[model samples]
Target chain A: MPFSLLNLKALMPEIFLVIVASVMVLLDRAVREKAFFFWMALVGTVVAWLLARESLDLHFGASYLSDHYGFFFKTIFLLVLFLTILISPGYAKREGFHFGEYYGLLFFAVCGMMLMASGTDLLVIYLGLELMSLSIYVLVAMAAGDPRSIEGSLKYFLLGSLASAFLVMGLAVLYGKTGKIVLSELAGWLTSDKAVLTGILFFIVAFGFKVAMVPFHMWAPDAYEGAPTPVTAFMSVAAKAAGFAALGRIFLLAFYPAYAYWVKLLIPFAVLTMFVGNILAVVQTNIKRMLAYSSVAHAGYILLGIVSGTKEGLSASMLYLLIYAFMNIGAFATVVLMQREGRVGESIFDYQGLAKLYPVPAFLMLLFMFSLTGIPPTAGFIGKFYLFRSVVHAGYPIIAILAVLASVIAAYPYLRIVMLMYMREPEREIKLAPSPYIWLALGLSALGVITIGIYPGSLLTSVLASVF
Target chain B: MEKVLFGYLALAILLSALFAIFSRNVVRSVLWLLVLFLHQSVLFLTLQAEFLAAIQIIVYAGAVLVLFLFVVYLINLREEIRLPKFLGSYPLAFIAVLSMLILAVAGLVGFVPAKTVGSLSPGAILKVGHTQILGEHLFREHILAFEIAGVLLLVAVLGAVVLVRRLREGEL
Candidate 1:
């Protein structure tokens, strides 16, 4: 085939992201200050975002798409990536992990998420998943000599590769039934034939693993607790978003005709994920592990949107994801900034009297925690409201009520952090001197949560417009 | 003649796969895997899938087996090899395997794959040469996937480098 501009136009954003990642790696050296990569990555991601915006309607044949759906997802990824890079430099410097590889691998992960969101074919999706997973595995282990880092990456990698195996096996089964690898083709195959139960089961298990749902969530707390803070923040938002993107496309788009079977399959898993994630989060002393379980619970809430299997449901998941990127990243930014002077302030006690020490960051952390707990006047509230409202509207009111119950239980831990930050006294004088970039990351995330919370109408309109 | 050869190949593959799973020694298990891969290639050849047969031999038997061997050599497996832990409780394992086989076959019994053949027929592919025809599809219709594959490889390369590269000058 000729190299048509039309065909390649849709891939411009992904191509640009990868190019930027490569350029960053090459430019990782020559600059003495490793933080320079952060600035460069930020600039490059913004440019890629602009490029993505331009191709919002260009669906490139069967293998890729650049529609508003993908464009919205790519925008979410870039948002997460931007904030991650903004906070990474300071965190890396503090943790003795100031390496060039960290910034480059982060961009590599961003590139992979972009591809996964844009991909219309299973092969492309699978490749993108691995690319992201590979980069993340390395990024998790970046603190080379740290025993926790090594242990975490090992557990994450082994389980991650097994999930990859399951995913490929699932794809093989689907292909065997239809002899096609494109997502669009499967729609026709399933609509005409019996739904392949084994194939769909594998997909659920694989995606379940990636999104850290229960029974497949054994790796998450350890990996999150042990990974460098910024890395954890990046994966919690972006990696999970990519997994949900794949799940939305594969199930909602391709296997949509067999929704009955899959929705029945998902409802129980959703309830279990919600209960396990929320209940487990409350008992955690380590803030990182608590957030990891919180992420799992958040994932369960998002799965509520998926379970409804309506267009509104899919967009609700996307909106929740958008709000989640800002709120969760903002929460982690505070933790990342607190890792100053070689003291990893990961324990819940570390936050005692944070308001007295650093009023601005403490306030920002409180705002994010509120958003996470789905309190009113926060984006998290709007996100969860829309998710459960849509699920209820879709005739799953019981699940929605159960979800609300889970959220109430989830509120206790988040509020506990607030109590520590505001009411309790510090054991020792905790030092927190966040860099300018950390401030910027925290400020932007805080602003995002507030702006979206006050007026979700505009963003919700756009999100609804993007759904197929 | 082809039928008889296919039967022989299938039997060899089955036997080698079982032995590979049950083998006491890792090295011997790898050898069994090689036999299985070789038989698979032969079976592919019998099915008129020449390109797949070649890939089965080249990529699986040649490249992947070598990588497996390298891994075996890289780690200390002597203790593991001497452990004699070849999945104990033979009766239960045998029953489990038999049941899985039965269920799998049962599930697949009436399932017929819809014909979604690529641009070239097997006969035409034979005439055009395996590599060339395969290259055409890979580069033409699936070119986007091809580029993505290139990106995957690049990520893998960077990952390997990041894992091994020492950031600071060390006393070691």
Candidate 2:
């Protein structure tokens, strides 16, 4: 185990993030201008993005890998971090919980996500997951005066700790059964033993909790609705993507021989997740809760790609997550825009007659809603198209059909938002908490959605190329 | 003799764990947890993981248990103990626990681990010293994760400060 300089260089992006976060913390005490911290975090993310691009394909010991797959996921995480920061300033100013630590915590979260993406060992991945979850728990509780925020953070923390416990227990069992914790080494112990099966089941439950599959998703909506709008957006995309990245790496690589067994185990959960998320979303009055459920449904759709267990299927999941970051965050950003003083803009009723008053923002919201529902010429549709195609290619047309039906059910809630905006008359005076940063985030998201939707070939090609 | 000692430690660990969970008094639960951690550490020692055994006692039994006792002291323990424990979901919880217990027993009955020993065998640990072996592995083999763990601790500290600090006027 020679400590090579190249291994250190491979970790440059994550190290850079840690440095920036520490600098932000120190600067926060001295600088009165909050925008300074924001600018610093923004610059830090851009630099880390560049570092990640430059350091791709480098390996750090046997425990950490910075291959194409990890690099691509890191790119997604940095994108999510960028969009989250862009959307945060406005909401933080409006809500009065904008601390320097918010930005720092976000950087730390992306750092953790990068670790999860690159970690080659189970222990490293688990630590990375914990880092991400702890930052998010604090972010969720940042608005300490809000009871909902406190409750949400408490629930997320307790349940998340339990999930981590399950993960540790799983790893212990796995280590005992196979005498291995590294993903590359675990493949050798693929015998159909009951102890190994139990270990794999624990891994499934742990990762299932991370990705919010079906029964494990109860914490999502409450946590989402209670957190700050930008934080919620970040959680829906970035956290879930990190989970899927680690889940894909561990299950597809480590458990390759038992692929059929786990895929069979996951299929029912995936179907249940889709139906539960979509059907429950239709009844939600709170906008955040609805999107939370929608995200859960999206998780099921993404899980379809993984359960397919083909290169094409995994790549489609990556593309789906990449596109989901845009459309989902865009939808949440619109909710942020609707945050006028004295009204949190959490209710679907808040959007009634929005198109009549603010046509531009309303149109943006409509585009996002359409994309979320998997309509054509939006990134969400392209994402779903490839996912279902991959599933079909993998000879699971039944699951694909079921997913499409679930998406149809998902459409009702997504489109209902659009319908409320365009058709209903104004019941009250609509006031928007307009900010330049939110507009930038929304515009970038819209641009991504439309560009990738129409001509997804380039992104698709890279996604396929990077399916390590 | 070694087998007998291992058996005693295992039974003690299980009994302490059960008592930790089912104890009505919060303070009593914390004490039971201490016993559980101590027994578990001895069990680790029997497995030839002396470093892990020491850590189990130092971290979990020492620091973590003390923290638990502090928390219990700060809270109104009488009210907490008076609350109905199961909240009417006893049957469902019982079924789930029973099934899981059965599954674990079934799995463990005929389980023989695959023979894939790593470099850190008992002989290797004895030659190099357990702590030295662990230090070399942590610092050289897994340095990236080690540094990341440091960052994780920093984030935890920062989170605690952010959550507890009072806000000033016009400060984000």
TM-score of each: 0.91, 0.95
lDDT of 2 at B133: 78
Candidate lDDT values, in order: 0.85, 0.87
Q: What is the interface RMSD of each candidate, in Å?
A: 3.2, 2.9
The window of 10 residues in a row where model 2 chain B has the poorest summed lDDT is: B78-87
Regions of model 1 farther than 4 Å from truth: A1-6, A192-195, A341-343, B1-26, B74-77, B81-109, B118-133, B167-172
Maximum-TM-score candidate: 2
DockQ of each: 0.43, 0.54
Question: Residue-wise lDDT of candidate 2 within A372-449, one digit each (tens)?
Answer: 999998888999999999999999999999999999999999899899999999787788888888899999999999
The alpha-carbon deviation from the true structure for residue A29 of candidate 1, after best TM-score superposition, in angstroms, is 3.8
